[model samples]
Target: MKIRQLQFFFLAIFFVLILSGCGSSSATKEDKVIKIGATAGPYSDQVTEGIKPLLEDKGYDVEVVEYTDYVQPNLSLDQGDIDANVFQNSLYMKDFAETRGLDIIEAIKVPTAPIAIYSEKHDSIDDVEDGQSIATSNDPVNQARALAMLEDLGWIKLKEGVDPTKASEKDIAEYIKKVEIKPLEPAQLPRAMSDVDYSFVNGNFAISSGLKLNGAVYLEKTPPHYMIGVTVRESDEDAQFVKDIIEAYQSESFKKLNEEDEKYEGYVLPEWMN
Candidate 1:
C-alpha cells in the first residue's frame, strides 16, 4: 500500500511538470507570433518583402495574411484575427472604424501606389475623344479621387469652392471632354478597360492584374491622406510589435528596397523615406 501511494504521488508530479512546461512553451510561441494582413497584391508584397524580414530579425514569427476585399482586413483586425493590416489609407480607416464601431488606428504610412487612368483602347491622354466613355470606382471616396484626376487633366471642371475630397459627378461644373463617366466596382474597373475607352484603375488592382505603373495614361498626384498605412487595433497602437513595424517601414533597408525594385516603381513614398 505504501509503495502504490508513492508511485501515484510521483506520477502526479510528472504530469504537473509536463503540463507546466507545455504551457510556458505555448505562451512563448504565442508571444513571438505576429500575423499581418494585406490585400492580394502590392500591399501583400510589401509585407512579404519589406516588413516580414525585419520582424523575423527581431525573433518574431511573421505570417502575412492576404485578403481579397477591402473590408475583411479591418474586420479581422478588430476581431483579433490579425495583429496589423497594410491596405487602407488613414482617411478610409477613420471612416470605416467610425461607421462599424471598430476601435482601430493607423500606425504609419507605407509606400502607396497611386490610382491612374488606364486604357486598352488609347495610348495617351491626347487620344481621349469627346463623347467617349471612362469607367472609375463607384465608391464615393474613390469616385471623388477619380473625378479630381479628370479635373486636373483638363478633361473636366469641378464647381467653384467645392471640397475636392467630397466632390462627385454632380460637382462637375463642365465636361471639358464631354466623355461619359461611368462609376463601376473598383475590381471591375480593370476589366472595364476592355469595354470602355478608358478605366481608372486603383493601384493595387492594376498591379495584381499585371498592369505596370508606367502604362498609365495619367497618374494622380496622390495626396498624403490617400497614402496607405499599417493599421492595428486601438489597444495595440503602442505595442512593441507595432512600434517595430513603424521602425521597419522607416528603415533605410525598406527605402532601398522600394527605390531599387522595378516592382515598386512609381509608388508614392512616405515623407520619411523621401
Candidate 2:
C-alpha cells in the first residue's frame, strides 16, 4: 500500500512538469520575432532606417524582408510567412484581397506615391503635339487613374456614365481631338518617354530611375492621391506588437523625416493620423 501511494504521487509530479515545460516553450515561441515585408525602393529603405529603430525600442525584433514583385508580399502575409507589409494602398489592397480571397487589413495610411506624366519630346502638357503618343501604366487600376487624370486635364473625354474606377482605353468611345494613348507597365514608363511623346510613371519608380522632378511636365498632388499603408492579416490587426509598430510609424519623428526629404517635395507626406 505504501509503495503504490508513492508511485502515484511521482506520476502526478511528472505530468505537472511536462505541462509546465510545454507552457514555457509556447511562451518563448510567441515572443520570437516580428517580420515585415517591403519592396526595394524608398519605401523599404525609409522604413528600415527610420521606423525599425522605433520598433526596436518598443521591444520588437524588426526584420524588413525585401521583395521585388507586388503580388508576393500579400501572398506571403496570407500564408503567415510575414507579420506585416508596407507597400500598397487601400484601393489596391481591397482589389488584391478580393481577387485572392485573403483577409488582410490596413493598419495605417503611410504616404502616397504621386502618379506623374513626363515627356522628353515636349516641355509641358500644353506643348504636346497633335496626334502625339502618350504612354501610361499598364496595370488596370493605375491605367484607370492615368486616364482619369488625362480627362481631368481636358486632354481626353470619356463616354457619359463611364465609371472612373473601371475606366480603360476601351471606354474611350470618342477620340480626343489628336492624342494617341499607349499603355505600358509602370516601370517601363520612364524608358518609354524616349520612345513615345509622354509617359505617366509612378513617382517612386521615376525617382529610382534618376528622372528629375524638374523635367516632369505634370505630377499628381499629394492630398487627393491614394495613400499607401501598412497591412497585416485581419487576425493580427489587434496584436499588441503590430499596434506598437504602427504607433511608432505615426510618431512626430517620422513626420519630420518626410518633411525634410527633398525628393518628396510636394509628392508625398505622412498622413494626418489624428
What is each predicted model's overall lDDT from 0 to 1?
0.90, 0.79
> Which ten-residue region of model 2 has the weakest summed lDDT?
265-274
lDDT of 2 by residue, 55-173 (tens): 88866677899876578999999998888998776777888899999999998877655777888778788886678898987877778788888888788888899987679998976
Candidate 1: minimum summed lDDT over ten consecutive residues — where? 89-98
Clashes of 1: 0
Error of 2 at 3 (Å): 14
TM-score of 2: 0.86
Q: What lDDT is reached at residue 103 by model 2?
A: 98
Which regions in candidate 1 have their CA more than 4 angstroms from the true location?
1-28
Please write out the lDDT profile of model 1 over residues 1-274, one tens digit for every residue. Answer: 9999999999999999999999989977886899999988999998899889999999999999998778899999999899999888887788788889999998898999999889888888899899899998887778888898898889999999998877989899999899999999888888888899999988998999889999999898999999999999999888788898999888888888999999999999888777
lDDT of 1 at 156: 96
